[model samples]
Target: MTDVENVAEDVSLEGFNPFDPATQQCPHQYYAKMRETTPVFQVPGTDIYMVTRHDLVVPILRDTATFSSNFSTAGMSPDKELVEKMKEIMAEGWPPVPTMLTIDPPHHTRFRGTVATYFTPKTMATLREPVTEIVNRLIDELPADGEVFDAVTQLNVPVPIEAIATVLNVPVDMMADFKRWSDDFIAPIGSNPSDERRLEALRGTVEFQHYFAEQLERRRVEPIGDLMSDLVQSRIEADPGDAEKGLDVDDEGKRELTMSEMLSIVSQLLVAGNETTTKALTEGVRLLAEHPDTWAKLRADPAGYAPTVVEEVLRLSTPTQGMFRVVTADTEIDGVPVPKGARLVVMFAAANRDPEVFPDPDAFDPDREGLMKKHLAFGKGIHFCLGAPLSRLEMTIVFEQLGRRLESITLADDNEFMYFPSFMLRGLTGLNVSITRAA
Candidate 1:
């Protein structure tokens, strides 16, 4: 299909506006409607064409040129205000933008490559012993006091953050703050951020950025065993010494990542990489608790079922609800005309649950055979998550240990799940549960 031939015949047609929570709280029903009728309809409200079909979403996610991701939103406008909003989400004084996640190639290529060296799957695998050791020790420390604690507070919360913190060289005493900062940074509210959650998260972001700036300075003065130090040496600029606060010189003496970019990338990794995996573990246990038959199956063979559980959870409950893209020019997406500057929000969670794609989509079936790997939870193409393998490893170990720790598990009386209020993330603040060890 040619690019010009792709746009819908009528540009005036209105699309189903998905940004509204009414559309968000239950997006699947609406997606089904869109895919079934006028799959490429334009929305006068948003000035963008909605792409609901999985087939279309897969390609849109892959094509960065035709569909730019420089501006990230939930199918909203690619307006600078939205980009600025994304920056503010990271931390204030954060350069009116963060790092490579939202930028296009050339800049994104340079920035992403600098961070990739440290996060490769092989590098992550080498740490399994250490990660497993940490998991074992944490479970071993589980209260013998009969408190019947919150698994989230007890297990889910600590593992991933601790692992990444160990990488960042964050101090032990600051671990709680690390969790809090991640929470507040992404949370709709923030006691941890202080003030009215908005201002609080903003302030936390500034301090967070400032800390990385200082860390970058130290790394420049002395080489260290960390990604930050490695980033300090990339070939971004003609001279490493000439690298300024916001942009840096790479090993090749070209523009790589700056100090500000470093903070944004690190902060994004902390929140996105850590929280998603942690929630998957926490929710994995919750699902197991709800279905003992499944939990029993996992306990008996952690290697086999743990992986499927991750996929199942990802399909059923994606950590990221949607990812936005910018239309390069007037383009037809799934037969809809998206003008230049329009934002295309691809709803991963909804697409995963689309009845056309998954049979009985809501059912929690671990053996959800057939095309299961096609799920869009990790996203697609170059933007596919780098932490995927490590995330799989972490969950595998988690369930293996949880199987050994609890004799039996069930949701606590309260059922008080502090679900995040942000449109971007769908994890809870905490989920308390009761447990007993197997004899």
Candidate 2:
């Protein structure tokens, strides 16, 4: 047996709880074992199956018909009391509806289509100047050379939130609330919070919905050229055709989005637009701080190497680690039978580290062969991340700017390097770094 297989064999899967805080801290060993022995692993005492191998993950992601993205059917039962309380709170605002992430093809296509134009590579490229300005401004605010600063709060968090705010034409002054709302949106899925905490988050969600509803109304009456205006003005075909056809918005079935649908889409855009990107930025800094040699290489040629660094960081960090998918029909992943109604944790982070695909997968190697297209960090198939282009652009620019401005980035003496407690999301809670300004 190879060394990886040997290592995999040493780690037992018995009583392995993916949701455990310990597992969340360092899941790589468990993932390695799963990938090698049981690529389709069922979390003990649960109906959820985690798909680990890259080859298996790709097919599962592609076969959206069999593996549905509609997570409502995933058998996740939250606290009844909490649900009732949240429903009561949510009643004050627009009804919550499934938009991009939750719904399947035809509906997903419709929701994704309306805003797709704004996130395309060309459109994202247009924001390069503003994004660069945001990055530099944040860097300027960092403490003087050789001082310890919390990169997570000072730089990583603000950069993406501000950039996304710029895109959505939302006021950056409301950034704290924006971050809180974003956290609330993913609270149930990402952080397995307490009933009280969950209720608090729901209240925040209601506030978010109300705030965006007003924004949508303003955009409707007077269409500004921002993303919100585009979303408000854009019409979709009334008859959302089959998934295969993919978003056929002809004049025949043209209609504006309902208030609920508009709210849902905007909520998704806000949460997804900033949250994952924030995590990616945090992870990138952590990775750089850990590997001075890699940082040195990146500093040597910021423009040429920043993109590669971004991909490597994405591959290794994998901010949005795993996305939940439900089995529509009875299916078998790599001969492991998964019953209908079973929930599948499509492990993108694990897949990125699959040795069969990405050799020496754990190492931060920007020069890895086929590094650009191989990593599933942005995910694969139709339900791929909509904000991927924007995320990439932000990372590329931030890293380049860091490379130019900072002489060296080293972990602070007091750095704990702890990640946020989330089974689905992997991001450092904070990263304290000491930097020397480049001459």
lDDT of 2 by residue, 1-439 (tens): 2111224447899999866777777778888988888999998888889999998888888988998888873223677776788789889888877888888888789889888988887888789999999999989989988888898889888888998898888999999999999988777775567788777988898899889989989998999887788887877767645233454455566767778888898888788788888898888887787788989988999989999999988998888888889898887878989999999998998998988888888777888888778888888989889989989999999999999988989888886667677878777788888889888
Each candidate's TM vs. the true structure?
A: 0.82, 0.94
In terms of TM-score, how similar is model 1 to the real structure? 0.82
C-alpha-based local distance difference test score of model 2? 0.83
User: Considering every candidate listed, which one attains the maximal lDDT?
Assistant: 2
Best by TM-score: 2
What stretches of model 2 exceed 4 Å from their correct place? 1-9, 73-76, 239-251
- The global Cα lDDT (0 to 1) of model 1 is 0.67
How much is the lDDT of residue 223 in candidate 1? 69
